[model samples]
Target: MSKKPNIIVAEDEEYNFALIRIIFEKEGMNILWAKNGEEAIEILNKNETIDLILMDIKMPVMNGLDATRIIKKINNNIPVIALTAYALPEDRAICMDAGCDEFITKPINRADLIKTAYKWLDQ
Candidate 1:
């Protein structure tokens, strides 16, 4: 059996975070939520158990790109996937440059989202 993986989700939107939390919970994955980049970083720095991260791009205090950069510096082995409403090529490039492993646009497709998370967790 696959062991439960710890997922760190950073989303400023309350409803979005709740939806993701419900989905992951139903799938039997453990989750940690952060309302913004700073809080996400705090959680990450304090918790050594995170297996993967789903980071939202636009947020107050700090953004996902900045957080990804910092998190990568702290733990290069952990993977971070970017989630954003920005679907532009430049946006994707920016996320890539900041050290995100993948980019998934907002208004997320449920199957795709779950698949991406599971695939990374399996790896």
Candidate 2:
């Protein structure tokens, strides 16, 4: 990438958003926060430079899976990683089917977050 990667985090919880912001900032990634998937879609529409998305599966207004499906239609090239409390295999499969490129269970692992970000950013 020519510039530092910009990541959109679609998380409703205040603490969760803060955690992701801190972690992403430490890695020199620009971060954008969306309180729900609706806001996420708005951001995606307004900002074409976003490099990746860390999506929360459960949110008011619109859920991540639904958002991912629409987002993929708009721009399938942007990689979206689903982050949710649900660790079930079915949940992962559903996220992938919805257009998420990767899945990570919460409470977010710092190492995993950094590694996943780097892996996708490099790609």
Candidate 3:
């Protein structure tokens, strides 16, 4: 059997992280939580097998954009999906510039989230 996809969720909000964790866990994927960009980077450094990252834009200690940049440097192949409450065009552009492979707005939809995750994971 194939191994479960490992995903890191870099979000400061406990509720948000928990919601995401519940959603992904139901889909049979492995989920890791990081409260900030620094922690996310540390997790990535320690766990090289991470397949994806769900990065929140406005995290404390280090923002998702900064984290995405550093993460790309560490391993450009792993996909990073930017998650933000802001839906502005500039926000999407900024995320793309920071090296995010995809973008998803806040108040996440279960179907959309699963579809995007599967797309990136090639499931």
Q: Which residue pairs of candidate 1 clash?
A: none
- The residue-by-residue lDDT of candidate 2 on 1-123, one tens digit each, is 678898999999999999999999988889999999999999999997989999999999999999999999999999999999999999999999999999999999999999998888888
Instruction: Predict model 2's lDDT versus the native.
Output: 0.94
The models' CA-based lDDT, in order, is 0.92, 0.94, 0.93
Regions of model 1 farther than 4 Å from truth: none
lDDT for model 1, please: 0.92
The pairs that clash in candidate 3 are none
Looking at model 3, residue 36 earns an lDDT score of 97
Reference-based TM-score, model 2 = 0.97
For all predicted structures, in order, the TM-scores are 0.96, 0.97, 0.97
Maximum-lDDT candidate:
2
Residue 75, candidate 1: Cα error in Å is 0.3
Instruction: Give the per-residue lDDT of model 1 (tens digit) for 74-101.
Output: 9988889999999999999999999999
Task: Select the stronger candidate by TM-score from 1 and 3.
Answer: 3
Query: What local lDDT does model 2 show for residue 14?
Result: 95
lDDT of 2 at 57: 96
